[model samples]
Target: MISAYACGPGDEPEAAAGWAFALAASTFCDVVVVTRRRFEGAISSALAARPELAQSLRVIYLDRHPALVALKRGQAGIYWYYVLWQRSLRRLVSRLHEQLPFDVVHHVTFANDWLPCGLVGATSAPLVWGPVGGASASPVRLARWLGVRGSITELVREAITRPLRRLWGDRAAREASVVVAQNHDVARRFAPVTAHAVVEANASILSDDLAAGAASSAAPNLVGPRRAVFVGRLISWKGARIAIAAMADLQDWTFDIYGEGYDRGYLERQVRRLGITDRVRFRGHRPRTEVLAALAEADALVFPSMHDQAGWVAAEASALGCPVVCLPFGGPPVLADVNAHVVSLERDLPAALARTVAALPRGRGERSHRWDAGRLPRFLEQTYDRACATSAVAEERPGRRRVPRPARAQRR
Candidate 1:
């Protein structure tokens, strides 16, 4: 059984990752997916289209209070609501387990590590507690770019998480059979607490025609103005400013912003203030098809997000054979792989990214990104096997003591 509170119609990170894992696991065995009632329409629509999946997949939807649901619509206290919903799942999980014991209990969505996850404690079934993150944070020096409000927010979050990790993070990790961290920093944060932390990206190649795009855009000749795009919610921490700041120096490139948020004003101001008004275009949110097409044709994706747990855009861009210029921090470094030029935060970040963006076309031919079509299934298969094996060993040991798996954490 998997707890996927965010599973729904779109390819948002949590929803996509949760649905992807459930689909991948169904290829191996029957999958019991526990999600919110709100997604029933979309999920049912999808299953109706794929009859074969309906046979092996069982979905149980939990209803949330209307007040909480309404609050979530405006993006207020949603994670708090998620935590309450998760905490309430113990009874449901226990009842389900009593009727038919599950082989594994996986936590898929609300991937942040700081939150309380009741599913982890609800069953003795071997646990898979990620691919989760939230430990990654922006460097104080570089985060000054976020302005005073952003700076204080990060400072407060770091302060709060430190104690919270000690209080609960350690226990959660220690109990998890396999802690799948979304990034290396998150993995390292959980390492001392759990012996089974592994770094794996939560975002996979989810689009239908992405493989075709990946094959065709493997290498390209760049002869005209370079096109670099950023596709994400324009929030303060997303660091659209970093990309906008870099654009001033990148005369050969034209950056098209594909999403909008409150930060749109700040970012647009920066574009004008930089006097590169002609070079930058705030082409607000477009359809997914258009975004994918933009990625397929773009020279590079300049995504300089500060602490993104999993960058869906970076992974999609990379799979489309578009070079990614991202910071060495967060999920982009893991997902982009050889298809990217990771810009470090040490020197002038915008300048570093500018140089990387300028040189990306030449850099692509020097490296190869072997797109693994089977990466998701293969990962899910191994994770479940390892979870079962580890749980079996724990049951055999005195006091049901957890035993760490022999597999060392993957570095790449």
Candidate 2:
């Protein structure tokens, strides 16, 4: 597995996904995980606590050059750094494959479809890409919700990156044996490139963790003044402002936002301006355990991310039997069960949130939905089997072989 941004001891969404996938993979087979040097400490610490994992998991940490590290301060900087890292990674993997002759290589993270996976077609081994995403776009009608600066920022970003994404992502999709899209939007985007594309959400919860959470909590009281929680970065696209806006009318409910980002000041100001400071609290970034604890206790999760490929917290909250009020778009809708409230764009977001909260029944126990943790390893194994079979058929077909493109310029 080639996961450039894998996290184990960390709590970011990408990191959590990477770590979970790695753990799940190790349960089935010997796993070699390639990740950034920055995560070595976290991965090492996690492995130290589990000797069984240490025996089966071989980790190779590749360091980012100091110059590149210093340059990666903003979004553009990070993207460029990732490009350089991919270039370096290809060389490293080529050398590793000479000795190991891997049967299949799975490119796991930074799950953006816009970014090319270096391993695709670089080695003789069959390659699987994704569950990759980045296809969701913020609805134009919701532009005013982000305010002027955020709206401009989003528009500028889209204008600059969309063309490049199509050019590069198309190429990457073409080279993959199977493209595992995180959501329907990403699958649609990749449809032109490959027939083997499939939708399997990247976010999942551990069965044991869900069991523990369920055993620990009794039914939540659905009585007066319900408590709503928002778990995610306080960015413009995350739509935390929509949750805060809804708090103005629902004076009976209190909202606790549990993450920090550049938009903290803007959100705090919005809260003050609405005179709902007492009802809304911005609890800066909390640890994963803490966030889950809060979710287990809260009445509902108000998530209105305009362009989230998948909001992992929404899935976690649902696994804990907590109701989620989210936009009908994105990965949340796929992960959310019948208990969740999907707010459509036809109605005002804030009004919809208020209505969902008011109508939600209290004293609900933990949900019984089966977590995806057990399913991912099997899905990955099936993808590998399919890729291997396809590769075998292509190898035997005379005059059907396509010339491999250079890693730097390759795209679907």
Candidate 3:
């Protein structure tokens, strides 16, 4: 059996369903998707809809809170402590091991470093590993900025955590039987450690219907004109305020902000203070289905998030034939061929908005094709098989490391 361990409550139902469907359709394995207590309802309903996965894959909820988890572990600095916890994630797996008979455990994020500690040095059932990567900054630089601590504190924290991360993380990842990476960018980062690193493209939806929608240039033609939509939380890193500020003069375009978080009150005040209240609106946390329908009708999706593993909103917009304007690096590189306008964060965003406004008249075609349900499932099937066969102890080649055997390709 194969089990999946995910951190936090994943709200991207389509994405999660795609993963579970892929595993169930192709392999003899059963998938157990684990998440925090908060996300159970959203994730469970999403998975239940999939006929193939309804019986095979199960959802497991944990009471693991990030802040509380950190405190209980007595970690000094939250960010560095996160890294250490990531290094020691094996404890989580041991708990998971008791619930299911799984030969492989796929931990969803790099934040859960505890995973490696469980399987690192052990010579037992093979472990397939993948760590989220390709962030805006180097990990070391990011650590320094997390707290207001002086250079000495930063140095002390780094001194302790960096070596431990290297020692523990390297052992777990390097020792893994296979590592599945989301992109070439992520794969290269882990190249030195795992010999059997394979790149897997995230699956998205693109179809004839979405293409037709783009061709029609059919955003909900509101009587007074529908405002530009921002579909994320109200946080400094999320760049909602930046978007609101940039749109002050685009009176013709209203801004509807969605999602709920601690930053809502602060952001609302920012909107009011800017005197763009009529132009900016907050819808606050709509259901996923409603959000998708809203995206289909919106003129554009704006997000200037400072750092994200991958901008999921970009993918959603592509699926709905909605154009996106974001800080250049916020979205994935694959969208370069389709409906994305990458902007530079360092310069004036107003200039970027002008360019985005200029491009709105021309509707971009949907970039993603409707995902064939069997596509990822088939790919994973072969990946699991080949990795299992090449169970030889991994060796490094001086130049380009040897490519593992290609899994049978699926025709899109």
Write model 2 residue lDDT over 1-412, tens digit each, in one string. Answer: 5554555645566876788778877766667788888887888888888988975578888757788688789767878888888887788888887676677788888888887678865688777888888888888898988888889988987886688678778888887888888778888888987878988877867766655555555456556677889988878888898888888988788999999988999899999999998888888987676677777878888888887887787778888878888886777766666556878676487887677677777755357364467777777767877977776776677887754422221111
**Residue 141 in candidate 3, Cα distance off native in Å:** 12
RMSD of 2: 4.7
User: Per-residue lDDT for 396 in model 1?
Assistant: 84
Our model 1 lands, by Cα RMSD against the true structure, at 4.7
RMSD of each: 4.7, 4.7, 7.4
How well is each residue in 1-412 modelled by candidate 3, as lDDT tens digits?
A: 2333333224453335434443543345556654445456655565566566565666655444577664644334534544444434445556555544354545444332222344443223456654333323223433322233333444564476456546765665676677665545556556787778775544334344344444554456546654578888665556676677777757677788888865677778878887988888889988665676667778778765544435566667766767777664423443323767766544566566646754575444464543333455566666666655645333343554453332333322
Q: Pick the candidate with the highest TM-score.
A: 1
For model 2, name the residue pairs that clash.
170-411, 170-412, 171-411, 171-412, 222-362
The C-alpha stretches of model 1 lying farther than 4 A from their native spots are: 71-73, 207-221, 362-373, 399-412
- Model 2 segments more than 4 A misplaced: 207-219, 273-275, 365-372, 394-398, 402-412
Model 3 stretches with alpha carbons more than 4 Å out: 6-105, 109-117, 131-169, 182-185, 195-226, 249-251, 330-337, 370-374, 393-412
User: How high a TM-score does candidate 1 get?
Assistant: 0.90
| Superposed Cα deviation of residue 268, candidate 1 (Å) | 1.7
Better of 1 and 3 by lDDT: 1
Angstrom error at residue 350, model 3: 4.1
